[model samples]
Target: MTTKTFLKAGLIGALFSAVAAHSALAFPANMTTDGPTNPPVGHYEFCRSLPQECGSNPGSAAPGVLTREGWKKILEVNYEINQAVTPMTDKEIYGVEEHWAYPDKVGDCEDYVLLKRKRLIETGFSPADLLITVVLQPNGDGHAVLTVRTDRGDFVLDNMRNKVLLWSETEYTYLKRQSEQNSGRWVKLQDGRTVAVGSVSQ
Candidate 1:
């Protein structure tokens, strides 16, 4: 392998070893979905534009097992996309307040999530395992992230950070995410934080 690839493999191996050594200290295996919730307006519009991607897949509802290969792919995609995409809000890019779409080069948080989801799916991850999650930052600003459901736990890929962290490890308050059984539908998270309706921007 090339030097960069070799270094990446080493890093992933170290991460896997760390996770194995401290399995008991890991966060919850998954985030609990309370019930059906309203889809974010940006996601709704995204689904309307890409109906083929929003179809339900009941059989793949279960979280995918996070093998070493899967972990490597997740880390690579998260790091690459975060490096490749320049952060720009919808209002700055499309003259709108909230718009979600796959990023070409510059886009908002949701755009980063969408591109990460697409790339991971392309890398053989199940759509059900890759969720578009909405969250509230410590500052109360809305943000979006790609939540990868795996047997190890639910790891988040955020444009705000290149490191893949467990959902519980992040400081953001979980709000909702795309249903594993139905991409077009949403489910509330039992974060216990006050649910605030706000536009997700950079």
Candidate 2:
């Protein structure tokens, strides 16, 4: 074979190998879950106040299919909600701590999560795909984010940022999240981190 043809074939093979290696190291399509876990105090109370929002589904649940249009919608909702809601603690807003409810003008992290989940469901996303996840921030404080499970992977819609990122990409320690089979149930994440659960606030 000509030197030029041989060189071209060698470069193509190298490119394919590199791509394969990168794919192997890519983040998992789904986060691993352990046994059932206690729901966060705020989420428990929220379910009590709004039973309709936390009903259980009987059958198996599947992650939403992430298409170009769906991705665009997720971006829009994340950006809009983050921009619209001003962060405020429960003590400041409701004279108590750890309250989870839909926000009007201002709310804490969990509140932002709730609103985002609601909006996504209304926009044709499956309720099973929208999970309320509790995570431990870098400072050891508790925080919440909306975990959107799609065919591609689990992406986080955080109030702290408008950009949607994969669960593995975030710096926070994963704790637990709402069950895909049942919205009212909670499941512990396999993230091997132990720390005191601090008060959750924006």
Looking at candidate 2, the ten consecutive residues that score lowest on lDDT are 10-19
The clash count of every prediction, one per candidate, is: 0, 0
lDDT of 1: 0.82
TM-scores of all predicted structures = 0.88, 0.83
- Expressed as tens digits, the lDDT of each residue in 93-187 for candidate 2 is 99997788999999999999999999998998888899999888888788899998876678898999765777776888888899988888888
Stretches of candidate 1 above 4 Å error? 1-10, 17-27, 192-202
| lDDT (C-alpha) at residue 144 in model 1 | 87
lDDT of each: 0.82, 0.78
